[model samples]
Target: MTVFISPLIPVVIAVAALVIAVIKDYRIGTLIVVILAFTNVGGQQIFEAYHVFLLIIMLTAFSLTLAVLRGSVAVQGIKEFNILLAIFGTWSFLSGVIAIDHELWFGMIEYMIRAFLVLYLVYNSFSKGEEIFRLFKIIVFSMFLSSIISFFAMIGSLSLSVETLLSLFSTRFAGTIVDPNFYAMTIAGIIPLAFVLITEEKRIALKAFWIISVFFLMLTIVFSQSRTGIIAISIIFIYSLYNLMRKKRVEILFFIIPIIVILILIPPAFWFRMSVFVESLSSGARADTSVVHRLLLLRSALDVFLKNPIFGVGLGNFEAIAGRYTIDPMVCHNTYLEIASNLGLLGTVPFVLLLYRGFMLPKHSMQNPNVRELSWAVRTGLLGMYVAILFLSVPFKLDLWILLSIAAILGRKISSEKSP
Candidate 1:
């Protein structure tokens, strides 16, 4: 006996939020984007009926448009990365047009367009330092909320009876995001942000809040049992440790002790699950089918790229074409390979350049102490995200775009300060 709330409830709430945001400031619209970025509308599918994200995006766009019309906005000039992204997007659409799988191409292109729009909106919504910090706080706080829910979900699943366990842990404690790997990667990206927040906070209570949030984030990622997520967090942790050792050696224990304590306190089940990674390391031994499966898909992606090295088989066509090579007929599972196979060398060049520019800006902008600390976190967190996505084919994820947008904003701010 499942009960349903009228879809109108969410609709009304979204409408009211949008209206208030419009009446307020474009910054409110920015806040809305940050809020929705950390939530999803589908799983068992109840929330899909409410179309929460779709409504939020549409309303945010409308609010921004209204604000612009009222002379409250000044459009910023596009940056180098924006140009590369636009070129990449055009190539994606052209490839989709010529794709052998018309239906899939159409659906994928439509979704990609919406994703770009979200990126554009979020990028344009903030032009000041305060707005960016506000957005960052919302993003970090949303991550904290997500981590708490996922921690509880994992605990609840652990307590379930054997007969009921299948239904619960199937999602592996994913809260709003459906896939455990996606959820874990999301939290891992936040780990660096949490570090930055903790370091910058002056109030003891606020510092404590970020400290607890970091704990939950670590616990959630470990509980997720995602190898990619764990690997990503390891990279971030090592980078943070290196920075602390260079600048604040005594403070290194603050991070190290908490992680050591968490590991000691975690249940034995966590160790058993983590052992899959160790087992898979032995050559010629397939401890997990997914490892071998990814290799097969990677090989197929290489074949496809070799066959169509110019423009690719076409965007969104890898699964359609690569299925012939793999037993399960799945995605390439590697973001770089997926781009190579789907968009080919032509599109791949600009796509790679986009990442290069996005990352380089933050690396160069570190001369500004304020921007350096924040930008470093975004840079390293995004690097971890890029590494994590190497094992998953989510090129159009909102967080990736949000991160790139943040980098671009930082670049713009830094450049503006340097100008006469």
Candidate 2:
């Protein structure tokens, strides 16, 4: 006889684990949620119709409420970053209110709210340098896990051969994120964090783990075949090389060797794609259909922005109305352009301010010895992410928000240290 098990059993166990984690330590609970947010494992269809990730977040939030009531967690008031976030969120809501597709707008709005909550929780939960470092490690760990999963997915048959490798390079690796470009962008953002961990780690085993993680992550990006991801990786590599040479020259070998191997192993098709991408930038005649399509989308976004200079089409309305301007209906693949065309200057201004604040946090914290490495790591990671987003319409990415929160918390911690 076959025993029938209810699907709710797993859900109940997961809920219990999340509650226990939060009760023991709310920061740990936040980290668990961050891992889910980054890896997107909890969002998968593990429970059929139920949203396991949302349930975890709700339970964690409830546990946090209890912690606050017991005075274990202290709530802080609004600051500059919070003010900018609130303004941007409010403007987005207004834009959504007038959106052409209310359902799409509401969906995006809900995602934005969730991202903001993550930022708020992370910014408030951790205060110490060590705690912040753990947060970074957790993010790097998430990426490492994603890279491994992607590697296996790329090597479907687990057969090691030039033909198999070359065939795999022709295909993009989306991993758990389900979008090749976004997955590669996410990996690019985490690469610098992994590198920093390698440099700061005292134990040889941990350092080796980070170095291996970086290797897998680089491989994942290469398999993704995203030009934007490659560009971001180049920027990160140059920055990391310079820093390693200055601080830990010996560790440079660990960093450079993997890159050299990757370069040598990358198929000609990969190089050809890069060449085409570069040539297309200078001459539209040489551009592939994908490049031409993006160019058209860019023009459409500009046209929409011009028409609605103050508050463009409306949140999530660009996708609804894009077919009228372009041959195909799609969201503008450019984040800044998407924002400008969707919400106009009213929304873009505050959004840009929030990003500026995130960037400045690391700049201000550079002097603090306690968080100097972390500051550099966060800044470099953000630099890569910012460059990647120029070609991606991902305004509600939870990982980006979490990184910003880390920067904010580090900045505040540095400020507190400097104060008498």
Candidate 3:
């Protein structure tokens, strides 16, 4: 009865699970990678430094090795989009070589490479409709887990009350991502996937799970106090509402009930934060320092773009030279502006084309009846993400790349089904 187990036993079990994941299905390994990448667990200090990166490398290598053994490792799906990404990557590398800040450039390049690898792995590893659906479920589950973490974090940090909420206007619930805006946007982007799952799942228990997950996810956004996240989620909700009304009219309760609960739970402080945008528009006075700062950053980015219209000041050099144009000396808060100011037309053109290709994938896939719902989900999710990034300068965000790859994989599955 007093027999004890070694601590290494847990490690051994984990290794065994990982080996099974790699050998049984590369999709499982890829899903593990996605969960790690999205949760930002590997970046945390509790683990050894860069442990997440090592896990990613090992999982990716194992998955690719399995693909080779099964004769399934081939460059496939979204050829045109891949080409555009390649061109963009090449241009960024060339631009980075002459960057005003080599340190920043190196860091950016490293992130870019990792994001690209995730996209490549996901697109090639998944081909079947079931596989794609499973991927979507796993992604939504990961976000749901993140939302739970944020809920507890908020609870532990401060007592919940209207007065306390008002006093903590600056407090943002970031969950594990560490950045409130990005965390909020990430949750908003996954909401569509959750909605799709809700519509597809016939089991009451599972449907309820998704509904509760959505409620908590929305609550996290309100706590984040991110204006951009609010806008993005509003767009997604409107889209999902339209889709639900057209088809799943009865299931509308599943969507509406959670939203009502969130509306009730949302604090006055959130509305006050959101009101700044309205106040600025109505009065043409930038009372909010954050809004004013972002506008100044926007103007400076435009100025940089105009000054270096072809190749830009150089990749990741915008912040280094930002002080020359504006007092902020910060990277532009807008993703489009960040790219336009950093890479200019040479990089911007291919990058825009790549996004267009991603959109087109889901647009085209909607024609196939079997995959229509899934395609709609991907399109809506991508739309939310694209909108969210307008105010966030994150060109190398892992989630964006993963979503684009999902679109490509869905499109490829549709085409293969249509083939004779």
Q: Give the TM-score of candidate 3.
A: 0.89
Q: Give stretches of model 3 more than 4 Å off.
A: 1-9, 16-25, 43-51, 69-72, 157-170, 243-249, 281-286, 415-420
Off by over 4 Å in 2: 1-11, 42-50, 158-162, 242-255, 415-420
Candidate 1 lDDT, 1-420, residue by residue in tens: 999899799989987876785556766665666666655432213456335566656776777777788888865644776677777888888896669897767766765776677777777877554555556677888877865775666657465677565434233566677687887777777677777777777789988998887887777675566778878887877887888888865757767976797667556665655575466656635366777677889999999999989889778789898769976887888888888998998778987887777777777567776656677777887888888888888777777777887887777655334211
Give the range where candidate 1 is weakest over 10 consecutive residues by summed lDDT: 41-50
- What TM-score do all the candidates reach, one by one? 0.87, 0.90, 0.89
Overall local distance difference test of candidate 2: 0.79
Please report the candidate that would top TM-score against the real structure.
2
lDDT of 2 by residue, 289-404 (tens): 78778878888999999999998777878888899977788988888899899999998888888887887887777787767878888888888888888899998787788888
Q: Which residue pairs in candidate 3 have backbone atoms (N, alpha carbon, C) closer than 3 angstroms, thus clashing?
A: none
**Best model number under lDDT:** 2
**Local error of candidate 1 at 417, Å?**
8.5
lDDT of 1: 0.73
TM-score, candidate 2, is 0.90
Candidate 2, run of 10 with poorest lDDT: 43-52
- State the displacement of the C-alpha of residue 129, model 3, in Å, after optimal TM-score superposition: 1.5
